[model samples]
Target: MTKDPTIAIRDCLAEIAVLHGIAAQKTLHEFRNDAVARRAAAYAIQTISEAVRRIPEDWLADFPTEPWGQIKGIGNRLRHEYFRVDDGILWEIMTTDMHALKTVREAMLARHAGAS
Candidate 1:
């Protein structure tokens, strides 16, 4: 039902990565005591999860290196088990993993420049 869904997904992933990075910064601690950090982290995780979920399951077979299913699973867990969210685990994903995922998403966008 959506045109260029892949492009849309790539864009969302990039956005999530950027937002996650911003939230990950120590300066953001000023907001951490409030809802800012949690909100940003929640949005980032939701966006990533949505994008991953929209991908056809078989599409992941085309990119064996991508953690396509894992992304979807994480998103589900975060959304369904909000009470169980582990801040430390979220920090790891935001700081260590999102950067690499963002890079891959950027490459996807670049490869489909005309789509945008």
Candidate 2:
């Protein structure tokens, strides 16, 4: 059976949140120095971006507060240009952008849950 897109999005968001939380405790220097941590964070980000790309455009359109295009672009960049990924950009994205995305994701999940 096909999974509901809404549920898939929620799951992805939850995963992103967990990954962010795991990385949150470590300093930027730690993240930069630890290849394992960096890879884990990168994978989580790529996963979230991939899921965001799969979400229906109409549903995404409803969330004007989120940066949908940029999210998708990040996924594309990560997928296509893995070798060129910059640690500083990843740090900025994880620290700032992910929080905004998580807030939007939570709101969307809540709204969907209410509708159901």
Candidate 3:
């Protein structure tokens, strides 16, 4: 059975929230120095990337500019090249990209709330 796209959206959104909680306040240097925060954020990012892959492109039509493909790559890097994952890049994504992704996700939820 196919997983529902909206559920995927929510799952990713939930993980993004987890990421923010893990590193939203810390500066880049602070975030990079903490091993636990890095791992937690990486895990959350992996989860979000998995969920992002599940969501259909048609459902995301409203947000044409979003880098859906690159977003999916995050999980691949985390899963396959685990040792090479960069903390600074992850911090940038979590701090800057996540809010935009979160906004898109919230908009997605609002856009599809009636259907579910």
Candidate 4:
């Protein structure tokens, strides 16, 4: 059976929170210099991407602001264009976009929790 869509949203929120924690540990300069942090972030982004993709289309329609297409594209780029990945861009995107994603996801979870 297909996994529940809400579970994917929860996973996305969890990964975003984890990525924020990683970002907290370092400045952009420090993040670029730290291989472990960078790798962890990449994995988190990949997970977030996958989780976003897993969200059902109907449920995703409820959050129209999210750029699900581009989010999935980022994961593809990370996987297939690994060598060309820019640390600065990754750091910037994570720090900038994550807040919006997290907020909506938290609301999504809350909305679902109330439904259940």
Candidate 5:
């Protein structure tokens, strides 16, 4: 069985994203003030961004269902507009946005795994 690059990247990213979500949920209260939680959340977003960035164009083409561009766009915004980021938006993204991403990741993973 040939290993697909897109699936590999997606699986790796999904795992990290799940970890980030878990961490974010665990520190929902403390994240408002705790430096560690803030940093961790930032790092989590960064990693998710990196995953999106690393996805090759060909691989992106294969997964029509996933919001590859949007995910990367958010990452670009976060990376470029660090100081201008609003906490409320970030909180909403972490909670609501991440769940949507999680669904996409799961669907892609299931499809790829089934294909294999």
Candidate 6:
């Protein structure tokens, strides 16, 4: 059975939110210093990016303002160029970019719910 793209995106967003919340109280240094937390964040980011990539382009077109390409690119980099992962950029993404994605995900979910 095929999974709904909206649900997949929501799941990924929720995972990212949970992982971010786990590391929310820590400083960048603390986050970077902890291998487990760092790996969790990276995995969550990759997951979210992968989901974003799978979502249909027409569906994505509805949200013209979201950075879908960049988000998908980050996932590509994370999956393909694992060696060059920058903790600082990851920290910045977790702190800033993710909130926007979460908001968008919530909107998508609500829209999907209404359409159902």
lDDT per model vs. reference = 0.68, 0.77, 0.86, 0.86, 0.63, 0.81
* Sequence-dependent TM-score of model 4: 0.92
lDDT (Cα) of model 4: 0.86
Top-TM-score structure, candidate number:
4
Per-residue CA lDDT of model 3 for 1-116, tens digit only, reads 77678899889888998888877578789888888888889999999988888887788777889998888898999999989888888988888899899999999988988565
Cα lDDT tens digits, model 4, 6-78, are 8888898889988899888889999999999898899899999888888777777888888989898899999
Measured with C-alpha atoms, the lDDT of residue 57 in candidate 6 is 78
Ranked candidates (TM-score, high to low): 4, 3, 6, 2, 1, 5
User: Relative to the unseen true structure, what is the C-alpha lDDT of residue 28 in candidate 6, on a scale of 0 to 100?
Assistant: 92
Candidate 5 residues 53-111, lDDT tens each?
65556545666877777777766777888777766566666777777677665655665
Model 5 residue 8 CA deviation in Å: 5.1
After the best TM-score superposition of candidate 4, give how far the Cα of residue 30 lies from its true spot, in angstroms.
0.4
Candidate 4 Cα misplacement greater than 4 A, ranges: 114-116
Clashing pairs in 6: none
Top model by lDDT, which number? Answer: 3
Ranking 1 against 5 by lDDT, winner: 1
Ranking by lDDT: 3, 4, 6, 2, 1, 5
**In model 3, where do residues sit more than 4 Å from their true spots?**
none
User: How far off is residue 70 in model 3, in Å?
Assistant: 0.3
lDDT of 2 at 1: 57
TM-score between candidate 6 and the true structure: 0.89
Q: Residue pairs in steric clash, candidate 4? A: none
Q: Which ten residues in a row have the lowest lDDT in candidate 1?
A: 26-35
C-alpha TM-scores of all predictions: 0.74, 0.86, 0.90, 0.92, 0.65, 0.89
Candidate 2 clash figure, as a count: 0
RMSD score of candidate 3 (Å) = 1.5
